[model samples]
Target: MKKKLLASLITAMMSPVIYAQPLPPVEVIGTPDEINQQRLSKETVQSNVSATSDVVEILTESPSVSVNQAGSISGFPVIRGLADVRLDVQLNGMPLLSSCPNHMNTPLSYVSPSQVDSIEVYPSITPVSVGGDSIGGSILVKSDKPFFAPTAEQVTQGEIGAYYRSNGNAKGGNVEVTTANDKISLTYKGNMAQSENMDAASDFKTFTTTTNASSGTYFTSGTEGTTTDKDEIAGTAYESINHSLGIAYKGDDSLFQATFSKQSAPYEQYPNQRMDMTDNDSNKLNLSFDKSMNWGKFNIQAYAEQVDHEMAFMDYKTSKQMPMDTESETKGLKASALIPLSASSELTVGTEIQLFKLDDYWVASPAPLPHMMQPNTFWNINNGTRDRYALFAEWEKELNPQWKTRLGARYEMVNMDADDVHGYNLDYFPTSGSGGAGNQTTDAVAFNNAKHAKTDHNLNLTALANYKDSDTFDIEMGLARQVRSPDLYERYTWSTWPMAAIMNNVVGDGNGYVGDINLNPETAYTVSANFDWHAANQKDWGLQVMPYFTHIEDYIDAVVERDFNDDFKVLRYANQSARIYGVDIAANRKLAENNYGDWSMKAKVNYARGTNLETDDNLYNVMPLNATITLMQAINRWSNAVELILVKEKDEVSEVRNEVKTPAYSLVNVRTSYSWNKLRIDLGVDNLFNHAYDLPTGGAYTGEGNTMSINGIPLMAVPGAGRSVYLGFNMKF
Candidate 1:
């Protein structure tokens, strides 16, 4: 199977060369950085931004990136089939931690697409200059910088934009104002957005309750259900607002900047989980300094952020509301310097320290008979902390005119600790030992008496070589060894029951999960290569092919424990060996130009597979093979495009978790934009054909108030959004 896939990839890469024709103008989406860095294009960023946009939406345009969506707004990016803590995501060069135990409020959820200037991506292999605590990949989101006037005279500049969409009745607006001079600059930005429940296609399938005597006639039985079409997706409404202020000072040889931001989200519902976000707020402050000297360049930065989050069961689901509160605080410092070693060589050295603290607890509400377990507050995690310190060095040199190489290394130390935690005892429930409030059990007592303190030491190394064989072709090869320590939630969640155990899950799998304190850090060794082919001018046509393989030691895997009952199995986090391999292909060509406009075509294909060597089972939630094609036309100030997306059926699923299979589907969309004077207008229709389909990586279905079985087996995935028309307007001063 692997050989056949490789052969098909090679055939696809060479097809474009054999059918060469008159090329059209090509828009470069990535700018080459030192060794393994790539910058997103302005056109690509603008095309994907909208009122209800997140960073994951824009990142999915890249060849090697995909997204796992649990709701309309809860989307997480997956790099080479790795996500969550395995990947490092930074906003304006600072790390942001999610306060929700379920990770409904991810780091990227805080930044709106309009506020982002550009994004730098490192796929599979990362540099030492960036932080070295992740094993998957790295993403850096940069905001618009303060502008300085050419002369001493002060200048004022700003922009305002608004957009509306029909699917969810979504509407939002953003505004920014800046006044600057050569010596000083000041800027302020604000945005607000709101949306209702999203509508799915007519044929979207969802599990509904039906009568069946053969399955023992139980409401929670998974074998007594059938699939049916649903129109509106439940528990998917959201509202958010954000504000930021910036100030900068520029001297002859030095520059200093400070920024402060605040975000408030009143509510965001998650359709793929049992709970919804009721309230979330965050505050951030950052300070940075840069100076130029005769020896080299120097940079210093410090940042801090705090988040407060609350979650509760939706009103339609249950009469009693169970509330969960969580808090997270993070502080970081980074300093780096570049020194010239020779005419063709430069060295970079840096150090970074990050401290994270978390507090999680829950309050149970009064309920009627059978379900009335406890009304006291439970301590999920008390004073949990994780600290990381790292030092790194990198060297980049031009060996000759056509050959270049980069070597880097990093050393990291991780320290984790937490106070004793407590939860509701099994004896407090009706099904267990005794139906009492204060009764204690062996499992709860053992967890409370357990000691939780651990430390890990890790080292990362990278080597990359690039050969500029000719003006139109380049070859790049890289090898990397990366390491990542277990997160606090994966090591300190102190519950073995269904309710408490399932609440700590971040993958939206709708299954209960318990943490194991003995998990070891994961280490990954990867080798990758990239081949780029372009026109002689490198502006008319282009094609890029990347292939990679990774082997991981002590990889995190979930084990099923069926000791509790037959209705559900408890999943415990454990360590094992795993392997992942994939290939990415992209091609673009400017076909021709006529009286109507200039025409062009672009296509992208992505494939990935992962397996655990210990259990010989497929990895959970792996994305299937997918492809996209776009046809574009450009006039003087107007541009139009149509897109076709295709996804293959996914059958290689995880047997341990009883993962579901998604059928193949295709979709079509059209969009157009026009700019006049200082204003621009955009109009588009998504899902033009109104095809009903389910996302392969959408996770399990947990729709509220729906007549679906609540059993945690034979998983039912959430359906994708239906047809929608949108209009947007933007103006500049």
Candidate 2:
């Protein structure tokens, strides 16, 4: 299907002969307004494509945002030090969920950076109409808008681009075509990418090991003993293809658009998880409508998405190959309207409904295990379903020339259910005396009789105010209460055995987990503020500072479930109180300029701290204080920049999991771009200094085919990518 779509796009581009006018110059990249929500323009997306193709990587350029990478191509976006279910990530207003148990196929993984037109980030305080059941914030990614001819004439426009990187021998290409007439427009886009295993810096350490052999360590070795490669990171290769088609109709007062997209990732290896994604395929269909009315503007959207995912071990370290298959389907609809109440006030109201279904199971494999008494198909989660209905209303009032305020509220009801599940033994495995092998006990009756239906009611509220003290200074303060229901896997997974529990972990902790049927929803109360300072002219310099705090009533956490053996432990999802606080500071200034070029300097610093209030323990996978500085120079149509990134050593680690501490490191990168008429070229060298480092939140190191110990500490953290040069080009016709 991918090949066919690519061929069709190529054929259409070749047959096009109607020459309209030359395409307009690409938009220039600039910093977003400090007082308003941040946005990443199309030019910024194009500039970063040389470094990475993933949309999540591009988002990291924004202040207070970071990425947790599991492989070269798979990464999860962390906003304000929050990740996973905390943030609402949407593509063109459509929400996407990960189908993999380990979250290898995140929402952002579905859209390539080349296909994005813009990205809007609502940091800390989000409007109720955007989404429900989130605490961190919201990220909305918009693809290129449909084009319609202004006059009563038909026109065609398109672009073809390709890129290559030397680090992983990576190569990819993208194609976009659009045909528009007076009343209708048709658009198609296709992208394909593939890469081999990525290499680390020459001096990078692969693993940590102990000198003494007498002490038996559980965390220092792999489940199945393996060796590691120091120069190349194992299980960091991937290949993917995606295609999207859109059709739109435009009128004087109303417009309608429909889009269909298909994505297929043949495989993506995860060095942080025990298994790798062998097959991942997804399909999305969305329809949206907008109309102008006397009272206001009305909008409506409906979408459906389906995903089929599979995972397995492709190496020889494990005697048994555990292959898992999972499938998810999501359908949703949202409608909203903006109505003007007064000249200084506007009211917005919206409602949303979503239904999700999931199935998780493992097929019997050929490999045999001596620890198990017998083998059978494991029903991890059977017919799991989650349904949500929400309603929201927001009012924005410009109380006076100096003060503006926004008030919003939302109510949501969630229903979750699943069928009875069973483990391979169809029974509870006891650690002590038992009828099963290895002194294990099995109780099939208990698991099969467990209840699976649950429901939750969640309500959220927001109150925000902006005060303008002067032309050059402004302050914004926001207070919000948000709620999030437990995911299906956290509420419905019924297995307690090691293998069954480990398959449900989303965090790359290399540990097994079980779900609790009676867990309560998480409710968070937050307070945030942003201060902006700039020159009166607004072009020479600017400064912005943001501070935020959040307290969660029933945050989901893991509790160790003891078994008979001392080498292995199982974790069960539980509720606990937690708190997180952070601050972000950024500054940009036009330093100097000459006849030959102009120069500017920009710097940003971010810090976050989280803790389990009840246990007084540090939160897991929290990124430490980091800072970035950049010097940019531009001359005519060419732009060049150099960046220095610094990270502080992580000393506050998770006590529950005994998380490893990452050493401090600094890196340098350089990038340049040039454009001429219809062609554009981008060149970049990442990690210019060839520094060896690891991401504090990169998750556990599960790299196989290597020894898993460095000194005394377990080498369980994924290493950052090594130095690499990339080159790319694009031509529009």
Would you estimate the TM-scores of all the predictions?
A: 0.90, 0.89
Mark the regions of model 2 whose C-alpha exceeds 4 Å error after superposition: 1-36, 203-228, 316-320, 367-374, 426-444, 563-568, 705-715
- Per-residue alpha-carbon lDDT of candidate 2 for residues 1-733, written as tens digits (9 for 90 to 100): 9999989745533443332333222221223232236777888788887678788888877787887776566687787878877888888998777776787788888889889999988787678978878888888899988899878899999999999999889999999999999799999999999987787887455443322222322122222344445666767878999999999999899999999999999888787776778789999999999999999999999999999998875443343456789999999999999999999999999999999999988865543443352465666777889999999999988999999888999999999998765455534332333344321234233444556688899999988888989988888888999998998778776656565565677877666677788999989898988888977766678788989999989999877874533323567889999999999887878877665456788888889999999889898888899999988876656678899999999889886765678999999999987677788899999999778888799876665522222122244567788899999999999
**Global lDDT scores for all candidate models:** 0.77, 0.77
**Lowest-scoring 10 consecutive residues by lDDT in candidate 1?**
215-224
| Candidate 1 C-alpha lDDT tens digits along 1-733 | 9999989755643343322223224565444445666567655676565534667888877877889885455588888899878888899999666777789888888887777888877888888788788888888888887799887598999989989989889888889899999889999988887887677887454444442433322222111233222566655678889899999999899899999999999888776777778888999999999999899999999999999999874442333456789998999999999999999999999999999999998765555412423545666777899999999999999999788999999999999988765554332322223222323243445555666788999999999888889989888888999999998888887666665666777887777677777889999999988898888776679898989999999999899854444434568899999999999887889888665567798888999999999999999888899999999976656667899999999898887766668999999989887666777788899899888888788777665432122364344777788898889887889
lDDT of 1: 0.77
